[model samples]
Target: MKMKKILWFSILSLLLVIATGCEKEKRAKTKEEQIFPHNLEFAVFELTTHQACKVACGENGEILISLQDVKDDVDTNCSLAQFDSIQMMEQIKIYAYLNINGDSTRLEVPSKPCGTVSYYCKDKSEEVQDVFRLIDEIRDAPAAQGDSAWFFDTFERLFGKGASIDHTPYRIYLAKADPTKFDAPHARLEDYRLIFILTTK
Candidate 1:
């Protein structure tokens, strides 16, 4: 009877140690994610005009996607919101990151034009010009898990076929009502100099 009790105790202790180790690993990973979010090295940009967009992940200084509003077919009718429920594109662009899965938080005001920004460009197909208006200053932002497919999916749905969906995904988390704007969300065209900093404050 004493032997049986000792054996049971030993097994229980081993299980507790294993469980503790697993829990510790999870905490460490979560901390890492929170600390460093944006992957600047693999960052990509899409030049949007006439309500169209694209993604170019690997080609540095190359504008991968160029969306054009051909046929003038886009307006109130046959819009993105009309396709199933893809309301994320607008929110993502405005918010800097799409929250595919997160709690419903407060909605902030849409950013207005604050000031002008300049970009020194070289080694690209198109001329270098700052497309986005400066709303906030560029600073180091939190690491974000951006969805490359978020734009890719919408562009393909809007343009169809030849739409660009080829790029690496770096997740981003953005809010509607947040005060800080004009950073990543405000980035326009091919400005490799501008770096996105997701604000958590």
Candidate 2:
């Protein structure tokens, strides 16, 4: 009788191990299936608008998503504003401001070109910490020792400088560039995704 009991216990242990292995394999398969464009594997976050997001890309890229924006109830009241939520901010190319990280965390530095779009979170890592340090350096740096107006105009990009008037008689035009792109009268975060690509300099 004791022998039979021992045999039963061994069988149970083996079955438990097999089950655990299968579960792990299932998870591994799922991870493999989660493939993004350009063979990029990103760490995601739930971000917010007008909020500063500090992103870092190591061997494994990092990203912050404003899940809130996904469900944000946007309200806009403009004289002439009708922007296609599809082709604007969601999938625009970010060529110039690729390596900049500032005007978000520090109060001393004024935002240039464009303010950092960020959100709040509670995850910490060495890679992100390094980015913060770099931000400090950028903040302290002199303002290039010259007039910034001579440089390229971000006003056109951010505030829609030369907005095309649908009707010139009344100055009908699309909404100014802002974070409300994810809200209603534009696009919802549910159907579309605000993918912010992260790369290192």
Candidate 3:
């Protein structure tokens, strides 16, 4: 009788453990599916600014934007703007708006050129020539210091001298829909737009 009771207790304990393990696994799988549905990876976009000019000049510099995939689990309620990153799952399209003399004009910036090159002038470890080589391929004019330089210079060359340098230049907008589906001018998605107040020296 004693042996039978001990055996029954052991079996019950084993069943409880198995049940708990299965429950935990089910919960984890549900959470994982919620975060990365359809086996698609999610990425966070970052805009890193490098000061090309002296400290006294303020925020006058180059902007290197990068998109990195998120490895860790994220909160379900968290939005892309909350992390100061663009959400890739929504097919976000970035638009460049150049503000000249209180007038805003949308520039024809190809999506391919937008994130191709990210370089820092001060980073001595990276080959300077290699950086210039990459920039030269994408840019219309000669490679100027970095990406921001190329951007501002290109516009100025097209419009007129001092078109960007004389004033606060452009604003970057991120639309949450497909590039082809939505008209950037009509969309009122200001919450996702990041206004980069870039100036040239």
Candidate 4:
């Protein structure tokens, strides 16, 4: 009877070990499947206007705009103003403003010949943090530095840049550029993205 009991105990232990090993292997495979390189997809939506982009990409080789959403419900009696905007590529080249840490790039803006799209970074790792930092920077930076005058002018020509129209609120997005989709190892994603904003007069 004692010998029989010992044999049963050994078999149970072996069965338990085999079951545990199989579980671990399954988990490992799941992790491997989700390990998609740095590439990710994002979307941007404007709450007030109901305008949204399915996908936004980065210009040059630097950064891409992925997810942008605005949920502000504040009431404002503002009118839309027209703008005359130049092509983003014509006005500037795409460039990334990286944070102190190499792990993340905060924002991607066009490198204009005469203007600077200044940005601030709250946290160098997270995407939402970077967006808030960018807003803070825009609020603090000098108007001349980020003057989208040409863009406004072009918009005005197309839509009417006067002060009587209702001004539309806008939002921006950022995403990780996919090397596989672009197929350029060194491509500074300057074209496959949603660029800057064009507001009215």
Instruction: Select the stronger candidate by TM-score from 2 and 4.
Output: 4
Candidate 3, residue 188: the lDDT equals 33
Across 69-135, the per-residue lDDT of candidate 2 in tens digits comes to 2222233322244555634333321111111232232111111122223222244333334333333
Q: For each candidate, what TM-score against the reference? A: 0.25, 0.21, 0.25, 0.25
* 51-158: candidate 4 lDDT, tens digit per residue: 233323343222222323211111211123222555422332223332211324333322232122222235423433443344444434555233444333332332
Ranking by lDDT: 3, 4, 2, 1
Q: Which 10-residue window in model 3 sums to the lowest lDDT?
A: 66-75
Predictions in order: lDDT: 0.30, 0.32, 0.33, 0.33
Residue 96's lDDT within candidate 4 is 30
TM-score, structure 3 vs. true: 0.25
Q: Better model by lDDT, 1 or 3?
A: 3
lDDT of 2: 0.32
Point out where model 4 deviates above 4 Å.
38-107, 110-201
Model 1 regions more than 4 Å off: 27-35, 41-56, 59-113, 116-201
2 versus 3: better lDDT goes to: 3
